[model samples]
Target: MTPQEALFKYTLRLGDNALIQGHRLSEWCSKGPILEEDLALTNIALDNIGLAQAFLKYAADIEGKGKTEDDLAYKRPERQFYNHQITELPIGDFAVTIAKQLLISAFEVPLFSALSHSTDETIAGIAAKGVKESRYHFVHSRDWCYRLGEGTELSHSKLQQAIHDLWAYTGELFEMAEEDTILLVAGIAVDLEELRPLWKETVATVLTEATIQIPEDGTMHTGSRNGVHTEHLGHILAEMQYLQRAYPDATW
Candidate 1:
């Protein structure tokens, strides 16, 4: 792919990840363990949605299409989306959500940090803002990991199971594709491979503090970078795009 095409896909990938993740988090509205956490999770969902808008808007602009961010997000087919598979998984128990958040936010912190220096001014500007938000996300989830991982036996067992279930998917977070290679050469993409070590360190520190044992590495789940995803993505698209699909021309 040419640099332009690569950049568009890269931006769309970022936007897709945020949008789906935000949707999952939004499901926790009024469902958090406490009032404070209910508000906190929703607030974080808003943050991810805002990030999605910025990135998808930029992607639309890059494509030079009249399409808006809403068009890309709500009108696209499931197979056309390029979000990480992990982001679209059904949010399980509170512990599962926390585990996914911890892993994702840990990766985002370094990814956004590196992107903050991207040669593309718009991407760099967005990344500079994103890095700050991701840090907060990391800390919030990390604290929860400690709380649940070291809590009562039931809580600890659930948290450990969540970690094990999600560990395999973590490798896809650092997967590089043709678009990534193209943008990396143009100085517009962060080298995800380089971020892997840092992400592992961050995860290790949090798990260690929580007294959680890290799962032994084996086969890692892959694919998402090429528009391949779990079956959950179709379900997400069905619910998310329902209104738009039902009335294509309707506008607020």
Candidate 2:
């Protein structure tokens, strides 16, 4: 692919990750364990969605398309979305959600930190903003991992199971595509492989503090980078795109 195509896909990938993960977090809106936690998750959701808008708008500009961020987000089919599979997984339980967030936030902290210095001005600007938000998210998830993993026996058990179940999906986060390689050479994208060691170290440190045993790495799940995802993304789009699909061009 050309540099322009790679840049567009790279931007869209970032936007999709933020948008899908934000939608998952928003599901906890009123369902959080307490009022403060409820507000916290929703606020994070808003932050991610806002970030998604920035990335998607940049992607649209890069594509030289008239599409708005809303059009790209609401009109894309499941196979067209490039979000990591982990982000699209259902928010199963409180412990599971925390586990997912812990892994994702840890990855984002370093990934965005590097991207903040990208040669691409727009990507660097977005990453500069993203680094701050992602750091907060990482801290929040890390603290909760400590709490849930060391609390009651039941809580500890749930946290352990969640980690075990989610471990395989973590590998997919670092899976690079041809677009990523192009952008890497152009200094427009982080080398995800470089982020893996840092991500593992951060995760291992947090898990140790949480008194949770790190699961052994096994066969890894992947394919989202290639526009393939688990069944969960279909459900996400069905709900997210309902209004846009039903109303056609209706706008308030």
Candidate 3:
């Protein structure tokens, strides 16, 4: 793929990941375990969606296509979305939800940090702005990971389960896909295979600090970069695509 194409694909994945996760996070709008947590999750959800919109806009521009962000977001089928399986998983309990958020944002920080220096002007610009937001999201999610993992015995156990249950899906986070190859060749993306050790180190340290045990020997599940998504994405799309589906030309 050409540099332009590679950059476009990379950015869209970034956008789709953020958007779908934001949508899932929104489910906590009124149902959080506490008022502060409800507000915090809501804030993070809004931030993620805002970042997605910025990324989607830039991605569409790079594609040189007239498709709007909504078209890519609402009109695309499940298999076309490039988000990892973990992002599409149900929020489950508050602890699990926060745990996944921490994991994703942790991965995102380094990815965006690296992207901030891309040769592609548009991609770099987006990443420069995005890295800051990602940093904030990382901090927020990590704090909760620590709180839940280090708190009462029940919180610690639940947090540990959340980490292990989600660990298999994490293999998808560091594997380079066609998209990664394309972008890395173009000087517009990180070499994800190289990010694995850092990812493991940072995640393990955070888990250690939280008093959560890292999963050592679980089978590593994969297949997100190729657009193979989990079952939850279908359900997520059912809700996300509803307005556009119900009224093809509907506008807000």
Candidate 4:
């Protein structure tokens, strides 16, 4: 693919990951185990949604197409997205959702760190701003992880289960797709393969600090990079896309 095409594709993948995960987190709004945690998750959810919107808009501009961010986000079919499966997995419990956020934010910190220096100026700019958001996300989630993991035996057990269950999905975040090859070769995208070691270390450190154990299941759950999403994404899209689908072209 050409450089423009590569950049747009790469950025859209980033946007999709955040948008879908943001929608998933919003499902917990007003429903978290506590009011503070509820607002915290919602804040993170809004942050992800805002960042996704910016990334999608940047992608659209880079593509030089008339397609707006809303069009790309709301009108697209499930198969068109290229986010990793980690983002779409269910938010099982409070600890589980926090675990998901921790895993995702750990990967994103270094990923966006590298992307901020991308040869593509738009990607670099987006990444530069996003690094701050990703940092804060990890900090917030990490604190929650610690509280739950180190609090009580019951809390520790729940967090440990959450960590073990979600660990498999984390493997796919740094698994680069063929589409990534196009952008990486053109200097517009960082290689996901190279990000793996860093991602693992960060994840390992956070879990360790939280007093959580890493499972050795020796298995990885994959298949979201190609837009084959979990059952959760379809329901998310159904709700997220409802207004758009119900009133095509309707605006506030």
Candidate 2 vs candidate 3, lDDT winner: 2
Every candidate's lDDT = 0.93, 0.93, 0.85, 0.85
Instruction: Tell me the tens digit of each residue's lDDT in model 4 across 1-252.
Output: 676666677788889988988988998998988898789889989988988999999888887878899998999888888778878878887888888898899888998899999887877887888888889999988888889988999889999998888877877887777668888877878888888888788878888998898887468887777678878778778888999999998999
lDDT of each residue in 170-229, candidate 3, tens digit only: 988887867788778768788888877887888888988998888874677676777788
Clashing pairs in model 1, backbone N/Cα/C closer than 3 A: none
**Candidate 1 wrongly placed segments (more than 4 Å):** none
In model 3, what lDDT does residue 234 have? 93
Clashing pairs in 4: none
Instruction: Please report how far candidate 2 places residue 97 from its true position, in Å.
Output: 0.8
Worst 10 residues of 3 by lDDT: 217-226
Candidate 2: what lDDT?
Answer: 0.93
- lDDT at 90 for candidate 4? 80
Per-residue lDDT of model 1, residues 125-165, tens digit only: 98899999999999999999999989999989998999999
Runs of candidate 4 with Cα error greater than 4 angstroms are none
